[model samples]
Target chain A: MGRWKNGILITYLVAIVFPFIFLFLLSMSSGWRFPDLLPEYFGFKNWGKVAGTESGIAQSFLISLVISLSVAVSSTLCGFVISRYVSYHPKKRLLTLLTYFPYILAPVVFGACLSYYFLKMGIFGTTFGVVLAQFIIAFPYALIFFSSFWNEKIKSYEDLVATLGGGSLTTFRKVLLPMARGLLMVCFFQTFLISWFEYGLTSIIGVGKVQTLTIKVFLFIKESNFYYGAMSCCMLIIPPVVMIYINKKYVFNKLI
Target chain B: MFLEVHDIEKSYNKEAIVSELNINLEKHKTLSILGRSGCGKTTMLKMIAGLTPIDQGVIKLDGVRVDEIEASKRNIVYLYQEDLLFPHLSVFENIAFGLRIKKIKDHIVDDRVIEMIENLELQGHGSKMPHQISGGQRQRVAFGRAIITNPALLLLDEPFGSLDAGTRKNMQTLFLRLAKTFNITSLFVTHDLKEAILMGDEIAYMDKGKLKIYKDRSSFINDPETGVLAETEFWKQLKTEQF
Candidate 1:
């Protein structure tokens, strides 16, 4: 049983590590000879190019940043606010089910179905259009994540605050917001990462015009630029990794 | 009357939760309301605090009709059973929250909170967060937070219900001491009969949305159906057995 457990652990490690090793190596490889066990050339040329202002990689990074940050901040805020009301509603289950509809469905299918609306609104091929599309997916997740936060105890706390002479604003600022602060950060990063890695929705809604990091990655692959694609993938993985590290290290989620 | 609930009514789905509930509590008096679960004790407390709306009644505080007033402006503090201290805030900060919101001076807030910490016997633990404290200490912080605001009415819903027996007893004693010191006007609701007897100056019993306030504590103790009389008799018999 011990050996079997070790075997499973090793398999899990390899499953995760191998792709990272390949991606790093591919990104660094200046040239790889055909039928060779290893690359004939190795350099940081692809990585440099991705970071350099000459390549559109930096612009794609900024675009993805704006879209992700917007989606994250807005969705989390709206979700936190709305979920409180929704949680106590008579049809909460049905409303929550509605929220899951956009997310649980295949992203490409979801995007394709909503593409006509994007065009009709003239938001297609714009940054706002892509951000809005991702928000649709991310907001529901925020709702679901925060659905259970407002229980009877929290309701009592709200009353406690109100009765202590704190109005709605103060109740939220002093009690609700502070209490859910860690979860807010979690939701922000989760939704940010969701918008960051999103390709299908951006493709369909942005009409391949709004160039986010994921779009750039696909462009790299489609153009057979494997090194740059690997470089983009590496860049794409950084934020979430940093976020997860912060979440584990710094955030205080719950005492009990 | 310091606080009055005149013909208050509430219903959910056509089932009355509190029907024509009426009570009066004089200033600086503690009323301990005893009831079983789902007996509308909590609802009545919330109604008084303006946290829950009353269907058909007026709630007056010191000659001012406050039922129409928003809960935030009511100056009534409700301490829940679970302490509900803000986990992110230190004990001092939690106690100082109401003062800070009122834009009280920094030194004044600090002085009051420090004094309260000492009074509550929580001197060194002031800087610690709510989660860092024991359950009994946390309840003390909640009490401090509510009382420091000098609320017109303090409503406690089984404030020590989550504590162990020893801690509960200690907290009850501390509460009574503080109630005397501050002369706090309060309405304490609990399911425990002994706790009700110990906590309140005037005892009231509630069942099925109706409340019966005993004019004297002895009458409340001596009431037949409330089980207190039988409980007292049992204790008397046990004393006889001991002798």
Candidate 2:
């Protein structure tokens, strides 16, 4: 049994980590060529080019950060309210189903639909439009995570708070908010990651002007700047790593 | 009349659950609802607490119609079987939840929670999380959570059902003593006839969604029509460890 478990663990490790190892090697390589077991030479040259030069990658990084943070906050807050309301009203399942329609659509197809609407509204290439698109795409994830958590804890606590003469706002602030803190944190991180790494919607809606790290990475790949693209990919991995570390250190232990 | 539940009815899936239920509760009294599972006892309690909606009829508190009032504004605290103490909060913080909801001053919240901790003999346990405490301690914390804000009505749904027999008896005693001490009106729901007789000032027998009130404990125990005698016989047989 132990050996079987170790075998399963190794399979998961290979499945998840092998791509990163290949990408790291590719990023460090001096040249892109086939028929070589390894790159002839490796250096910090790619990292230097991306970080030192006036590459738009840095700006893209910052833009992605802002957009992701905004999307995470707005989606989580709105989704929290919608999910809680649905939980209170058993008859609102149809409304909940309607809210999830965007999430069920193909990302590219949904992006096309949203781009059409944004174009008609004259905000197609704006940062606000991009943020709005990301928010809609990520809202269902937040709703699902928070709704499950709310279904477990909020109903009983709401009853308890109500019995104590707390109004709606008071119940939300005092009971629901505190009880939901952990799940909210989870939703925040999840939504932020989703928005940060989103490529298809951002590319389509932002129309190349409202660039993000993902857009920069894809652009570098298109330009055949393999080293710079790999470096951008590496940079793209940092925020999620930092987020997971912080979550493990601060949020995980207190969540229960 | 501190609470008047008038003609309250609820149904699920087009089937009647509670039909035109009416009851009057005064201050500092114990009303125990004895019923089988799925008999709408819990539904009635939730309706009174405004946690569940009434399909028809009205609930009034102090002669003020409260049917449309939100559950939070009803001032009806409910204790569940699972204790439902906030796992993330310490015993003191768990008890302070109701007071905090009422936006009581921080220092007073501290004082009252501490007072409850002492009164309930939960002194050293105040700093511990819900999971760190015993079942009895958790139940006491739940009771403290409900009573801290001095709610106009307290609803208990088999609050001691999860405890061991010894702990259940101790909790019953503690509950009665605390209820009397605070002069708080309470409605308790239990399947155990012995529990009803021990804790209830007035016993309500409910079966098949209909409620019949008995005069008092002895009358309830002796009356064959109320099914109390049969239930008591079952309890006695179970206590004697006879099949």
Candidate 3:
């Protein structure tokens, strides 16, 4: 039984790890193209060019970080408030479900809708527009994660607190917030990852000027700059990796 | 009068859970609601605690109409079967929850909580989490949390039902002593007839959704049809054997 379990674990690891390893190798190879089994040469030039000091990597990286962080924070906060309202009020169930409808809509369709509104609002060619678009895509993730967390034990605690003469807001701040700290962090990080990796909406809404790393990478691939494109792909993986690491180190154990 | 329940009715899905229930409790008295399962004893206690809505009745504490008041504003505390102490909070913090909610000053809250901990014999356990304590200790903590606010009504929904037999009996005695010392009005719900007899100043027998309140202990044990005395063999044995 143990051997079989170990075998299954190894298989699962290989399934996830092999692709990234292949992608990393492809990104580093200097002279590889189609019809070759492997790359002709492997070097650090591509990585240095894309991620080094002068490649505009630092600027694009900063923009992506700022946009993703803002979207994550705003969406998670909004989701927390909305979920709490729906959970407590009970009459707002229909409205809460309606708020989540945009998340279920296809990304392309929602992107189209956002573009139309952004044009009307004169935010079409701006970073704020991209952030707004990403926020919408990430909102439901935050809502689902935090709502489930809130629903699990917060309701009962709230009732207990209320009976103890703790008003709603005070109970929320002292009891609910402390109990749910770990889950809130998970929601924030989850929202950040979703916003950061969101290519379809970001690409569509960003159009030509407001470029994320994913967009830049896609554009490079289109132009057959596979070397830079692969490097960008590797760069795109950095945020999620760091996020997962931080989550494992800090947030995972604290969650109920 | 410390607490009064006037003609409260509650129903779910068109089925009445409790209908036309009335209770009047004096300060420092312990009233126990005894019933079979699904007899709405818990529901009645919850209504008194403002944890559940009363469909057609009024609850007043010290002559204030509290039927429509929010649970936090109503000065009635409820303790659940599972203790329901905040798992993340230390015992002191859990007991202080109500005080903090009332926006009491920091020193006062500390003083009150410390006093409760000492009175409840929870001196060394103040910093421990709920999960760190035994079942009996947890109930004591829950009681401390509820009573720290000095609520006019303290409702216990089988508060000691989860403990072992010996622990439950010990807690019952401890709780009765605390209730007397603090002059706290209490309504305790239980399925155990002995527990009801042991703890109650007045016994309320509930069946199906109706409540029958007994004004005296002898009346509850001696009445022919509804009496616990008539239903118990030990009472019969004692009646014949002791005489």
Candidate 4:
């Protein structure tokens, strides 16, 4: 039984680690054919060209960072505030049900549905347009994520603060924000991931003009440039990896 | 009267939850309100604290009309049954919360919080987090947090309900000591008949949203509606039947 468990664990670890190792090796190699076990060239030749303008992956990475950060921040803060009202509202159930509306339709269809309004607002091919589009999807997720935060106990805490002579701003700054730090970090990371990896919505709203990293990955794949595709895929996993590390090291440990 | 609640009424969906509630409590005294669950004790306390909006009533604190004021401005702290210590803060910080909110100077806050921690008999536990403390210690922290604020009135809704009997007795004694030390005016709501008689300088019984304040503890014990007679009879009958 012990051996069987060890075998399953090893297999699972290998399954998880295989893609990452393959992506790294594939990103560093070129001119490899199917019959060849390894590529003819495997070094930093492609890696060094990342900073040059030819690939533009650096610019794509930066743009993707900005869009995701904006969406994550706005959506997390708005969701935190809005979820409180929804939690205490008389029609709490109805309001909660409305948060799931964006997920009802697929992202591609949702983006397509919003294309007309995007064009009408004259924001269709802009970076701001992509941020707004991703926000539409990410915001609801954050709302649902934070809906569990407000309850009778939290309500009592708020009232307790008020009666202790703390005003609304003071109450939030002193009590609510401190209490919610861990959940807020978790929500921000989740929303950032949602915006970071969003592909279909970016393509429709950005109109091939705003080349985020995800779009660049697809573009590379479409042009049969597997090396660059693998490289961008490698880059795509970095932020989430760092975020997970920070969350584990700082947030979850303290929460536990 | 230090706290005045006049004709306060609260209703839900056209049904009255608390109707024509009235209370007059003097300064530096505790008014113990005895009522069972769903008897509008909490609603009455919330209205006085300005947490729940009253349908039609006036509440005065220190001779000033507070019904129209925000809860924060009313200077009435309401303690729940739970200790509700802020998890992110240390015991010292939890006690110091109100002072920080009022933006009191750091030195004064330090002095007062240190004094309060000692007063709460939680000297070395000041650096500990809420989860690290015992239930009795947590309740002491909650009380320290509230009393350090020096509010005009304190409303405690069965604040020691979750404690074991021994701890509850100790907390009651501690509360009386602290209340006298701080000269705190409060309305203590509890279902325990013994606790009501022990905690209150003035006692009141609530039934169906109306409160009847007793002239004295003897009167409170004599009033059958207060249920003291039945409780006494049960104790007497138990004493005779056993062994």
Candidate 5:
């Protein structure tokens, strides 16, 4: 029984790790057709192309980073502050229910519905437009994510700070922020992931002009360029991978 | 009176929670307000702390009106049933939080915090986070944090309610000693009958949003509405049955 369990564990590990290894190898190889055991050549040539302007991978990576950072920081901050009011509001239940309205429809449908306003505002096909669309989805997620953070105990802490001769800003900086550091980092990581790999909303709002890394990956896939697709996929996973590591090390461990 | 509250009122949804609340407390004294749960004890304390706005009242501290002041500016500190320590801060930093926010000199903060740590009997634990300490220690840290600020008033909402019986007894004793040493004026709210009698320089009883201040400990014990008479009978019956 123990041997079978160990075998299952090993299989699970390999299953999860296989895609990452395959993507790395596929990104570095080219011309491996049917009946061929390996690619015609395997080198850093494809990786080398990422730095040059011809591939546009670096540009896509930078754009994705900027969009994700903006979305993450803005959503996390707005969510943290607004969630406090929502938690304390007289109409808290109704307000919270409204936050879920964004998630009620599919992102593509939501994006399509929003495209009209985006076009009217002359922001369609712009990076800012894509960011705004993604934020619409990510913001609610952050709001819901931080809803559980404000409880009776947290309120007591705020009151205690007030009584201790610290104003609202002091309470947030000294007590609330430090108490919520782990949750804030976790929220940032989650929202960053939401914005990083966002596609449908980005596609509709970006209008094929604002090529984020996720869009580039889909573009490569559509053209049937497996090598570039694999490379873009590799690039797309980098931030999330780094974030997962950070969330684990700094956020989760501190939380525990 | 160091603190005076007159005809304070609070309501939720047109229903009264605390009504006609009035209190007068002298300097360097403690007023223990005893009540059962949901008897407006917390509401009254929060109102005094400026945490909850009073629908109708005037509050004066040291001959000046404080009802219009913000909680932080009012120089009042409120302690909850739970310690509510800043989990990310160490014991020293937690105790020194108010002083630091007030922008006291670093050396003064360090000296005062160290002295407070000693007074709290928390020696050698300054570097420890709140989670690293026991419940009684956390409660002590909470008290120290509040007292270190030298507030005009301290409101304690059952500060030791979560402790074990032994720890609770010890805390009660420590609080009495600290009250004298720091010259602290406070409102100590609790549901426990004996704790109310022990902790207060003056005693008041609350029922259904109304408060009646007792003349003395004997008067408080004699009041049936305070539940002391019933509690005494129960103890007497238990003693008789055990004997």
Candidate 6:
């Protein structure tokens, strides 16, 4: 049983890690021939080039970072508020159905449908437009995550706070927010990742103007610069890996 | 009467949970409500605290009708079964939450909280988080939190229900001691027949949305409808190892 369990775990680890090994090697490979299992040479030149301040890769990354963080904060807060209401509302089923709609619908299809409104609103091709577009998907995800979080226990806690002479604002700041600290951090990172790797919505709503890192990866691949594409993939992979590690080591440890 | 719950009615899905429920409790007196689960005892407690809306009734605290008052301004604390101590808060901080909410002076809050800790016999555990404490200790912290606010009426809903027998006994002793010390006016609801007798100055039994209140412990014990006399005899037998 122990051997079987270890075998299953090892196989699962390998399945997850196999892609990253290929991505890392591909990103560092400088001279590789077709039909060859290994690259002729491996070097840090691609990483060095991308790390430069002047590189478009770096610029696109900064843009992705800003957009992701903004979307994460806005979506989490808005979703949390919406979820709180939905959890207690008489029409909770209706609210929950609405919240899940965007997540169920394809992003590309949704973006296409919303593009006309974006143009009329004069937000298309701007930072606001991209962030707003990404939030459409990110917000619903957060709403669902949070809707399940406010259970009967939390309701009781809220009542306790109110009974203890805590007003709405005081209950939020002193009780709800502190209690939700770990989950909030997790939601933030999850939403950030959603926005970070989003390609379709950014492509259409951004009108090819708001170039995020995922867009950079696409551009690198289009130009047949597979190494640079792999480098972008590596850059993209690093943050999530670090975030998952942090979630495991720090944030989730605090959650019940 | 310091607290009067008059003709309170509550219903869910057109089924009455509590109908025309009336009880008047003196200042600093503990009213133990005995009922089975789903007997509307908890609903009565919630209605009094303004946590649940009363379909029709008046809840008067100090002769002031407070049913219309916002829950925050009601000054009625409800202690739940699980302790529900804020996991993020240290025991000291949890006890001081109400004072902090009232914006009491920092030094005063500290002094009162420390005194509460000593009373709870949790002096060494004050800095620890809720999960770090034992079930009994958590209840003490929760109890301390409720009374530290000097609430007008405290509603305790099976506060010691989840504890082990030994811990439950200790918590019951602690509760009696603290109730005496603080002179707290409380409505304690429990399904446990023995616990009802143990906790209340006066006991009320609920069945099918109606209340049958006993004016004194002797009356409660002797009431044929309550079956308390038989239960008492059984307890006596168990104590004498007659079972």
A161 in model 6: Cα distance from truth in Å? 0.9
> Per-residue lDDT for A125-200 in model 2, tens only?
9999899999888998787776676564557776666676777787677667777788788889999999999989
Predicted structure 6: clash tally: 0
Tens digits of per-residue lDDT for model 3, B178-237: 898888888888988789999988888888889888878888877653547656876788
Kindly report which residue pairs in candidate 6 clash with one another: none
How far out, in Å, is residue A249 in model 2?
3.4
Can you rank all candidates by DockQ, best first?
4, 5, 1, 6, 3, 2
Pick the winner on lDDT between candidates 1 and 2: 1
CA RMSD of each candidate after superposition: 2.6, 4.0, 3.9, 1.5, 1.9, 3.6
Ranking by lDDT: 4, 5, 6, 1, 2, 3
lDDT of 5 by residue, B189-227 (tens): 999988999999999999999999998999988878888
Put down candidate 6 lDDT per residue, B1-243, tens digits, no spaces: 999888889999999999979899999999998888988988888888888899998999999999999899988898899888888889999999999999999999999999999999997998898879887888899999999999888999998889999999998899899999999999989888889999999999899889988877888778876778888788899989964
How far does residue A56 in candidate 4 sit from its true spot (Å)?
0.7
Which is the winner by lDDT between candidate 4 and candidate 5?
4
True lDDT of residue B56, candidate 1 = 93
Compute each candidate's TM-score over C-alphas.
Answer: 0.92, 0.86, 0.86, 0.97, 0.95, 0.89
**Model 2, residue pairs in steric clash:** A162-B72, A163-B76
lDDT of 3 by residue, A203-246 (tens): 77888777778777778789887777777778889989988998
Tell me the spans in candidate 3 whose CA falls farther than 4 Å from its real position. A1-54, A85-100, A103-105, A150-153, B224-227, B234-243
Looking at candidate 4 chain B, the ten consecutive residues that score lowest on lDDT are: B1-10
> Could you list the chain B TM-scores for each candidate?
0.95, 0.93, 0.91, 0.98, 0.98, 0.94
Q: How much is B188 displaced in model 1, in angstroms? A: 2.2
Model 3 gets an lDDT of 0.82
Per-model CA lDDT versus the true structure: 0.89, 0.84, 0.82, 0.94, 0.92, 0.89
Q: Estimate, for each residue in A8-61, the C-alpha lDDT of model 4 and write its tens digit.
A: 999999999999999999999999899999899999998898888999999999
Candidate 6 lDDT over A194-222, as tens digits, reads 99899999999988799899998998899
Where model 4 places Cα greater than 4 Å from the true spot, the runs are: A1-10
Worst 10 residues of 1 chain B by lDDT: B218-227
